[model samples]
Target: MTRHGKNCTAGAVYTYHEKKKDTAASGYGTQNIRLSRDAVKDFDCCCLSLQPCHDPVVTPDGYLYEREAILEYILHQKKEIARQMQAYEKQRGARREEQKELQRAAAQDHVRGFLEKEAAIVSRPLNPFTPKAASAGNGPGAVTRDSLSNATPCAVLRPSGAVVTLECVEKLIRKDMVDPVTGEKLTDRDIIVLQRGGTGFAGSGVKLQAEKSRPVMQA
Candidate 1:
């Protein structure tokens, strides 16, 4: 046999060996299995009703409940608060009305008291204008200055067609020469001065002196 030939006779015989099934199983040990999204079930509500929740609301304590149920609870509490406020306002309004009624009654009482006092004053019998006593210094018919001061000075023209006294003439002059009682006219030259021992007759003399001193104006 040639050593360089294609099939060398000096080479050792070779045999093909197949892999064992137990060694292939031992190569891959126990694997860590992970579950998919389809395998896990959805979480449910933690409420006492145990009903299914569509829109979930998470509390601060990390507890989940139905949104509509919790909102209804909050609304009920708010309604209670509103009712309390309305009752309080009604009580306050009633108190204000009572105070106003009391004030009105007090005002009416004050007006009644004022009217009673005024009626008492009007019912008095004393005449304030009547003189108490006549003094000897003043004549029998003569009125004192104190008595005449508050009296309304009046003038009466006698039917004799003569102006009587200076005091009467002055009173007539103040009334535009028309007699206060008889409505008759009197002249300054016709006046007679009456001696009453008082300066009451001085007005007519002063008036005459003033007229004499005034320059006559020609028109």
Candidate 2:
């Protein structure tokens, strides 16, 4: 027997014959025979092709055989599997490479989008109309007492590019349904009060008046 516990030899034979002619009945005789080393190895395979099993596969009953040979012998007895196996392996390799490339491209796109957003935020310009503190001198753009005295109370109209007094806006809204300048529909909701810096336009008096009015306006 081999190390895997398979019988490595042929069975014994028992021969018996009656007395052929004159001798009494002869006792039974036994003959024992053994297989060679190559034959013993071949006996382990289901295919019995007399070759060493390169890609060995074990059966449920603990028998070993070459994988392809046994598959062809049992399943596709007459067909070949070489071309089909090669094609399957090639397709699997191509699919793996395609998936890798797709992942790489997606990563690159994400990184590029993040960089573009950061660049846009970093390069954005500051607002030019933002207010700054004025020096004590009478330079250009400085707020002076003369300018404050000249400043007047006004209300800006929406979509009409018109500036008028708050009292005129209140009277127009009360009398007409549309703006006299642009002919657009007028409502108390469209009025925006304007205030001059360092002037009395945004003082407690205007706040008191606004608090007393309907749809209260802010300066």
Candidate 3:
């Protein structure tokens, strides 16, 4: 028995029935009959040793098997890493949403406080409801920087609503302790206008006629 490269064993002489007429006079007696042109020549030869074969059971250390195992391992690792990354990305997205909500809430609080003070100032009825009364005497209250010492995060009144910036507020109230506009003293009314527009009073200047009967103005 002649052993081929690796672990293959060459069996008795192989004979094809179609080629039998040509080799009939030859002394090499046939053992097994070849079925077809495509049939393997050696039955004892490990089929896994062929070029495109991938029978791990026949040749565990074949190139196909080793490479296949390595590729499979890499693919599995890629899937696992992708799953973990997906979970991490989800968690990170949730955290970002939470942070945005907190920022919005803080901004709203600053605006609310500013509006309340302005409302108190503008709500106060003058001695008379006439246009002259509105324009007379000391005139409307003006916002200054000194009054908003406790204010946090500067606020801007917009037609839609109030806008608050954390950095600006800290600078205005804590560091500079001044109003962005007027560049003068900060008053409680200024803080409110900063929070809500001056026109926001009486829900867009809707006066309460009954309040005129009161002896003293209520802010």
Residues 1-219, candidate 3: write the lDDT tens digits. Answer: 334644323435455653575566575766455578565534433343433424343345543433455567669999999999999999999999999999999999999999998888855522211111223342221223222212332354222122334454454444554544335555444433233223324654434344345577789
Where in model 2 is the C-alpha error above 4 Å?
1-151, 200-219
TM-score pick, better of 1 and 2: 1
Error of 2 at 75 (Å): 70
Displacement of the residue 174 alpha carbon in candidate 1, Å:
35
**Which candidate wins on TM-score?**
1
Residues 123-171, candidate 1, lDDT per residue (tens digit)? 5332122233447442121212333321233222332332233464554
Clashes of each: 0, 0, 10
Q: Each prediction's Cα lDDT score?
A: 0.53, 0.57, 0.48
TM-score of 1: 0.29
Model 3 Cα RMSD, Å? Answer: 26.7
For all predictions, the C-alpha RMSD in Å is: 35.8, 23.7, 26.7
Clashing pairs in 1: none
**lDDT for predicted candidate 1 compared with the true structure:** 0.53
Segments of candidate 1 deviating more than 4 angstroms: 1-69, 122-219
TM-scores of the candidates are 0.29, 0.24, 0.26
